[model samples]
Target: MMVQIENKIILVTGGAGFIGSNLCEYLLSQRNKVICLDNFATGKTSNIQHLLSNPNFTLIVGDIRNLSDCHKAVSGVDYILHEAALGSVPRSINDPITSNDVNVSGFLNMLVAARDAKVKKFIYAASSSTYGDSEALPKVENTIGKPLSPYAITKYVNELYADIFFHTYGLNTIGLRYFNVFGRKQDPNGAYAAVIPKFVMQLMKYESPIINGDGNYSRDFTYIDNVIQMNVLAMLTENPEAMNTVYNTAFGDRTTLNNLMEYLKKHMSQYDEKIASVEVIHGPNRAGDIPHSLASIEKAKKLLNYNPEFSMKDGLKEAVDWYWNNLK
Candidate 1:
């Protein structure tokens, strides 16, 4: 059975973004009070529009980059799921300064606030990109490689800060290194949009989806539902060993980009057969991108009892259905 985190005031930073908004909605459904702090720079208002009506859901228009804003959001909160960060490797590559400001500086600000607020636990979103330049397959929690981009460096810095907060200030923290997460409400219109959502949007319109390389890059494409489950587990787990460590939040499988496109087309073809005929275009590989990513969920499974219920194919089908109905 899934552990329940109920009746507590939970803060979700970047709560207007894709994953953060979903976490807010779920927490509210479980009878918990949810405080969402967002600046809406990249987060869309449309994402959390429905939840605005709920009294249990409080929206704070704030930026994490500001220390005062972090303090305000952390006030009277029992726990925090810090999802606010500047994602996208290319964006960080183009402008490293802004990324560092929001990701590294903002993360430190949150850690300080969480410590001061005496929050029970601090669970923040880490990234698989921290495994940059590592040729190892089935990435383990302890092993990592040198960061390849500013974004990766920032995310790695988050884990470091979380660890120090735990040791120096006696804060309980967990960092979830999320792989290629996708599903409903993931914005498909952005220069830095994730591959799955971007491709799904294009295929729905019968537009040719461009592959960055020869289309063999594989990823452990995790479903949003699975990610949600992991977050909740990270929050509620009573195991002391589980505390003050990071876990790879993934579906424990890999799918090549070519296979991913084929899966998307197969799922979408159910609505429009012509989607199968849409040709895929190839382009140069993206900078700061690794060729393959897979995760070893054994650590998470044993420590947190994380049993991901969706394979890449299953998640892809669900995502296709959502985009077809909503984005179309």
Candidate 2:
């Protein structure tokens, strides 16, 4: 059964993280009742601190790895947005077991709880890394290469399990394959920090930023707003064609790392002129890194009517302005 957005009870796991927190705020603005589940591993309370006062929002500090917590979080929820997982390839490469525990086992636990609770729909955060080693430009939904890292494997497993639940148990599941999502409230100090926020932070401090692999490697860097839109559409979409399918949630454009640095510097320079002169250091390609990634948003558009509002340049400007004001 399709669930309406207004007044629906929604559970967003990892709702205190970058994308999750943004989703929480969006859902609440729509007047939906939202429950946020997090163990605070990578998520911070500060992300959702502004929304804490809203009566429509509730926070549960619990690990998804625990079945009881999953059950507890899913209770009385009409929709489930599973976003809690250990992210980053390097983090997984260093500790595959913990990644497995959180991304794989924890995902299964959430699936069981959501299914048993008879939730109307289950939407999850899939990754573009699942297109690992495929050498294909503008990756499509059906075609994918073998996963390159523990993190990639975990995200791939999410799609696989979601498919299984749909076939076997009649769970309505949709996976949104996110590509390099970035925006405000994104942690800039973490060791596995994403490119945009990290670069913005370094430039704000007038520090040199590192460009991996000569900055030629490009990515389909998505904005947090686009991801939030996809989640809402996934949960609210009533089109039979959209249900139980994976859609690439991206802008369908590519930006090279070198070009991205130039753009970032241009934007940051508006606040501090010295930032425009900051040199970017080059480094070797990191392991489990893709040479390039671009998503074909045709599926999302045809199925979910997804129309991304921000391009790379526009999204970066907003992100840079946010980091400049908040971090500095």
Candidate 3:
């Protein structure tokens, strides 16, 4: 796929991680000079080792928490795609201080660097967790509830800081509030892994995936390609209204855990028929987990002209294919 923007130097902060690595590859393929800054905390080296040989791609082994590292990474960069942060809600619950330091303090450092360096745009990875305690079915960008966890608090803080940076220092910014994103290169081994990859891996290994809360809870499961489209749109959008605001990056549909499991099992069964027989166990609901999440992508569609290409099932099949060829 052709990346929308090219020839300009772009900085991706978590470029060794799932989403960021993909972004780096896409940008490089589009003939952009891409700089990847990663500390590799949760990001894996293997994810980006393929790009080290690309002449247009430069790798910076650094952390966003450090202002100097941010400054270093931002030098000569035309745009910033800030994807670095501690992502999981449960991980934040267990270690709020660390999550705050990386997601909050680190974000501030990057903004300062971008402002100081005068980057053309500062786009970032926000979270659907920002919807928080709100009972709204389809979450809009403006309306939000009190954050339910420290991770959510940190993400909300990122939006607040970005808004202030735009208002105060005139740093042009766009925040993409990502829903439950899943696809190729996503981590499925860790304890804080997202549901789809974790479940996919389990089913592949013939292990039962534990469903937290009877598999009724649902999410606005988004694909990585959709997310990449959002970042590209955010970066290249000429609309004045699109700047300094947030957009929900999602496929704009909801899928229950039961349905998600059924889809995963069905797809994985094509590769290994035994996978369909893998039982799904029910467990108590996880703390800090919302019952349901759905996003109104109308904001993105209206502002950024976002047209997500993959639905849940389409993305699942692609992801299953990737895991089979790569991991299984």
Candidate 4:
């Protein structure tokens, strides 16, 4: 049975962010009324500025750290997609306390608010970083290792509290462990910028992009469209085996940094011929970095009927086009 999400009042926390804004746009396109809560901490208003005219979209500028703000945002909402968090391992390493305050404490505030509101289901953006130091090829939900950073610890804690909420308070929740998601609307001008967007931006300017490792580290570079699909499926799924469980939301493939650089250089050269000659410099491996990551999405497949529609190559082409047209 296919789940139809129509006319539902959904609260999308951090909807001004890269993933959150994309999710809000998708939900609005589906005829759902979306309330976007964001503090502009890491999220930018430009991401959601275009959606301001949509009648189905409501924007609330507020911090998640405040319980009253979360309480107000979750009110009268049918579902909660908690996407507000301080991401990036280096950022967390630079300031562990602030990261914990936002990712851990702020997460609890949202959970409490959603539970009180009696929202149908709560979905959050978990991370593949939770599989830190495991050395596992294809990471499964139940199998994990010791967290390598403060950011990893914060995300794993989200899963812990979510499970306790289900068992102790009977609040239904789902977590999607995302692996290296990238695409349109992703910010490339930040100190904690992700690899794909940053690299693309650097290449567009004909600048050398730095590879953080020996160019051998690999990741499941998921596209944002696929992430949107996973979120929608997690929220709408009615399968008895699906609720209260975490799923790995990835394309079930991996790409090394070196190969990814070559792919990006080839793709970007189509727009600017000079990009073909861009050099990539290798640097020391980053702290709290994983060597390789791949996801076994079988659980998401069987339980939520999640069918990822875009590969890295296909998604990157579309993303690069968007960046070329918009980010200039």
Clashes within 3 Å, all models in order: 0, 0, 0, 0
lDDT of 1 by residue, 36-130 (tens): 99999999999999999999999999999899999999999989999998899999999999999999999999999999999999999999999
Model 1 TM-score, all chains together: 0.99
Across residues 87-201, which tens digit of lDDT does each residue of candidate 2 receive?
9999999999999999999999999998899999999999999999999888999999999999999999999999999999999999999999999889998899988888888
Write out the backbone clash pairs for model 3: none
- In model 2, which regions exceed 4 Å deviation? 1-4
Worst 10 residues of 1 by lDDT: 1-10
Query: Please, what are the lDDT tens digits per residue for candidate 4 over residues 142-202?
Result: 9999999999999999999999999988889999999999999999988999999999989
Candidate 4 ranges beyond 4 A from true positions: 1-4
Which residue pairs of candidate 4 clash? none
Report lDDT (Cα) of residue 208, candidate 4. 94
Report every candidate's CA lDDT.
0.93, 0.92, 0.93, 0.92
Cand. 4 Cα-lDDT: 0.92
lDDT of 3 by residue, 204-280 (tens): 88999999998889999998899998999899987898899999999999999999999998888988999988988
Q: Return model 4's CA RMSD, one decimal.
A: 1.4
**How close is every model to the real structure, measured as TM-score?**
0.99, 0.98, 0.99, 0.98
